[model samples]
Target: MWKIAVGFALFAGLALYILSKGGDIDMSGEKHGADATHSEAPATAVSAPAAAPAAPAASEAK
Candidate 1:
C-alpha cells in the first residue's frame, strides 16, 4: 500500500539522519595520530597562548 511505502521511507530517512548526526564515523588510527602530532608542532609556535580576558574588578562597579 502507499501508506506502508510512505512509512518505510520515513523510517529510513529518520534512521539515516540519526546515524549521521551521532558521530558513528571512526577516525582513530595510527595515521591520524601521526598526522595530528606532525601538524601540531608548528601550530604551537605560530599561535599565541590564549588567555581569558581580565574580568572587571568588583570594586569598579557602582
Candidate 2:
C-alpha cells in the first residue's frame, strides 16, 4: 500500500537524521568512555568556600 511505503520512507529518513546528529547529544563532561575523571585532584579533599558572608547575624532581641 502507498501508506505503508510512505511510512517506511519517513521512518528511514528519521533514522538517518538521528544517526547523523546523535554524537552532539552526548554530554561532554565526565563520560566513562576513553576520557579521564573530571578533576585532577583526589575526591577526598574538600574545596574552601570562595564567597564571604555579606552581614553578621544579630542574636540579641531589640
Each candidate: what lDDT?
Answer: 0.76, 0.74
TM-score of decoy 2: 0.38
Clashing pairs in 1: none
Scored by lDDT, the top model is: 1
Worst 10 residues of 2 by lDDT: 24-33
Clashes of 1: 0
Off by over 4 Å in 2: 24-62
List residue ranges in candidate 1 displaced over 4 A. Answer: 25-62
User: TM-score of every model?
Assistant: 0.39, 0.38
Per residue, candidate 1 scores C-alpha lDDT tens digits across 1-62 of 99999999999999888879987454466664436555234444467789999999999977
What shift in Å separates residue 22 of candidate 1 from its native position after superposition? 0.6
lDDT string, candidate 2, 1-62, tens digits: 99999999999999889878886443455566656544455569778889986665576534
